[model samples]
Target chain A: MRTLLTGNYAVAEAVKLSRAKVIAAYPITPQTTIVEKLAEMVEKGELDAEFIRVESEHSALAAVYGAAIAGRRAFTATSSHGLLYMYEMVWWVANARVPLVMAMVTRTIGPPWNIHTDHTDLLTMRDSGWIISMAENVQEAFDLTIQGFRISEEVDLPFTVGLDAFQLSHTAEVVEVPDQQEVDEWLPERRQSYKVLPGNAVTIGNIGPNEYTAKLRYAMAKAIEDSRKVIEKADNSFGEKFGRKYGGLVEEYRLEGAEYVVVMAGAWCGDAKDAIDRLRDEGLPIGMMKIRYFRPFPKEEIKRLEGKEVLVVDRAFSMGYMGIFGMEVSSVIGDVTNVIAGIGGVDVGVEDFEAMFRKFASRKLQRLEWWPREVFS
Target chain B: MLTEVMILSFGGQGGVTAARILALAAVNEGMFAQAIPQFGAERRGSLVRSYLRLSDQPIRRHSSIKKADVLAIFAEKILKIVEVREFLRDGGITVLNAKHGIAEKSYCVDAAGIALSLNLVAAGWPIVNTAMAGAMAKPLEISIESVINAINSTFSGELARINARAAEIAYREVKKCQAGSST
Candidate 1:
């Protein structure tokens, strides 16, 4: 059904369609609505699921982790401080190889205290062995979430779908929600290699020797690397079934003969695309490479823009170094302009992107520039 | 064509809900729309603003509307607090919940009166959002029927009936006037 929904509600709809057996989460700004909707569905008997009201985000993920290990499809969602609060359990769940889906409505981590969009919170899990994907809009938030379960279950990995706080979470837009029968036909039952059954006495994540720990880490690394294909395949299958396919790991927009490419992720990519379109209409050779999947970083796709003038716009930065995403893209493309913009939800509109593209095309922008310069000045 | 609307209202006045209803109405009319409520640490009676974008094509830009093609003020008192002229584009339409029109392309409607007449009072405040939404339909280029359907689908029972009636009354009574004109 085509209906208007916020990204949070769309995610809840996806979870309902995915038939998540367990829903556990702690309330946090932006992310609260996703789980709230789920709880409402559960209460109204519209969805058959156990809605666990955990006191903290830590217990939220832990509850879902326990449920997933018991071979039940489970889900949880958090943002900003809530995600940080669940940091330890995040690693535990990922290393345990329990298939679960998490909706991360990304918010800025703060000392002054902010509840707005940024990638810093989600990017903190870069090496946690979880599959991370970002959605650019409400429809993709629904699509990526449904696909997250399919990919996670296939690879026995935890998946986190990130959408910008407020921009996607609070903004209501049209989303094509697939029928439960259609989703069920596309998503199979949760496949766990080994379930922690009631009769089975199994001690998972026991104390391991140095080599054993290294070996487990190696396996996780290999599984995630292999899961890239699974991600692509799931996306292709979803596209075929739902008639909507965002490019597997990275979606490209008019990058064919472009001399300059802007790479970004999250909801702002929509604005960036609009900027690129306007710039292209003005005869400027600029395109955008939106990173749909952040973890298992799209190195292959970044390599395609090797010779082009690549500009990476990161909403989150790795203090004392540079933008996290820019660092990764630069590592692959050798040299690229890195601009740290939109931090703490400082609005970066189409005009801002158009100006950035124009500056990059004219070789006027510095290699690393803080946007809305006055903030840094 | 893209029409951006900025709705200014006090918190708890359903300014955000008004934007949502209008967006839904636009969608029901086979157009793409986005309703973005400015999320903030706000309380009841605080100044709040929400945005709506209606377009024939998909809306890719998610930023806050800097210059709005239409400014819908839910409370006439909000005019004293917020400079509506600053947010509106050149020759933009103004839909004010007031007895008199305030701008060159202003549309005036007694949304509060309609809401009160319909007994649509919540927390001692007249619920003028639906009436204001109906007052906005003509200027937004969306059919009044679509707005009515959206209201019906959004609310339920007798509340939906009264709210839809308020919208209908406001739609019929909304008057367009020149700058500073009472009629």
Candidate 2:
């Protein structure tokens, strides 16, 4: 069904189609509207689920985590401080391998108390071992929320899908929502073949000493890496069945014969695509690399851009390290003159893209530090 | 050239609903229009920013609103909390929801008084926020009746009648900007 809805509303409806049995969320910007819509759906009987209302974002994730442990498909969402409040649970759920799905509308953490859109919140949880990805628009936000069901259940890990707060979450766009029959064919019921049994139950979490803890952590790392193959296979299989493909962990738009590329996530792609389209008209060899599956690192895909000058845009910062996206993309690209990007997400505008490109055109990345620069650095 | 404006208000003030009404008014006047809420955390005390990007051309960037031609501040106190200034383009209008007109050039209306006089209860009419929309329309070349139609679309049945009355009272309360007044 084609409808004009915000990314948040689209996600809420997608959860309905995915048949999530438990929904818990506390009101936070960008994320609140989604929960509100979900709450409404529960009230109206459009979406059959337990709309758990918790007083705090902490309890919200806790409810979903508990639900997932009970072997029910569960959901929760939050942004910024609300997400910060939900922070400790990320490590627990990932360790628990709960398989619940979370949608985090990213926002920059505030000292200035900003309500603008940015990726700092979501990126902060990148290493928390959740299967994380971002959405470029409402359609993907919907598609990914459903896709997460397959990825998480198969991998037996939780997933965090990032949409820019206010940027994608609130912006209304034309989205083609897949019908339930199509979605059902594309993504079937959860097949948790891991559970021992009710009659023969096994303890999932434990108070481990260093060795056991390290093994469990290494298993999570391996599981995240293993998900790379599982995700690619699932994406391909989903495309084959649905006849519409958004293949690869990273989606490339018009990059085949292009040189300069801008990496983006969430609704800001609307403007980045615009800037790319116009730059194309002017005959600039520029394109875009949009990372949808942010977790599993997608190193093989990043390796494909070896010699190309890719400009990575980060809506969130990494503080002591490089920009989160730039750092991750750097891990993939060995030694390429790629732009280390950090700019507009929620608080920034489309007009900001014009300036970022102008920087890319100049000798911006030419003098980038080579402290430990290797051939594949 | 159609003029566009944004009104930031509180939740109970009928902010989004009022903004929708004004956007519909602009559409009724044959202007290409868009009305969107500036997305953020949903809370009543926290800011509620709504955008009306009216122009001859269709708007494509449905992102954060950095600059607005006019800004309507519903709560007199929220002005201190949120970054309310520096967004307007030089001579843009700002309507305050205070009891008295601000020293700076602005439209001032006490909507609470008017809502009460009309004997409307239930939603306690965040009267000033509603009034600011009507005031904004006149300067931007939008007709008052069009805004009235917008309010009607958002609400109906028994509740709709009171809201229509609230909107009408709000229209009367708005004081227009002088032709050459420096904002």
List the global CA lDDT of all models.
Answer: 0.92, 0.72
Taking the tens digit of each residue's C-alpha lDDT, what string does model 2 give over A1-377?
Answer: 54446678889988988988899999976578888998999999988799998999889999988778777789999998998887888888888778989998877677778777777778778778889888876667887888888899988899888887666787655556778888877777766655444586677675768999888888888899899888888778877865556776888888978887776666677667767777778888888887888787777877777777777766665667666777777777744344333333334345667656656766454424321223227
Tens digits of per-residue lDDT, candidate 1, A53-109, equal 989999999999989999999999999999999999999999988889999999999
Alpha-carbon error at A304 in model 2, in Å?
A: 2.2
State the iRMSD of every prediction, in order shown: 0.7, 3.7
Q: Write down the TM-score of every candidate.
A: 0.98, 0.73
Please give, for residues B1-183, the per-residue lDDT of candidate 2 as tens digits: 535467778766656655666767776666656566756545665667787767665444555566677777777676667766666666677766654443345676666665666665345444554456666666666777887776666667865666666667666767743322222
Candidate 2 clash pair list = A29-B40, A29-B41, A117-A346, A334-A376, A334-A377, A335-A376, A335-A377
Per-residue lDDT of candidate 1, residues B42-126 (tens digit): 5689989899999999999999998899999999898778777999999899999987667789998999999999889998999
DockQ of each: 0.83, 0.24
Per-residue lDDT, model 2, residue B20, is: 63
TM-score (2 decimals) of chain A in model 2: 0.89
How many clashes in each structure? Answer: 0, 7
Give the root-mean-square deviation of each candidate in angstroms. 1.3, 6.7
lDDT of 1 at A153: 90
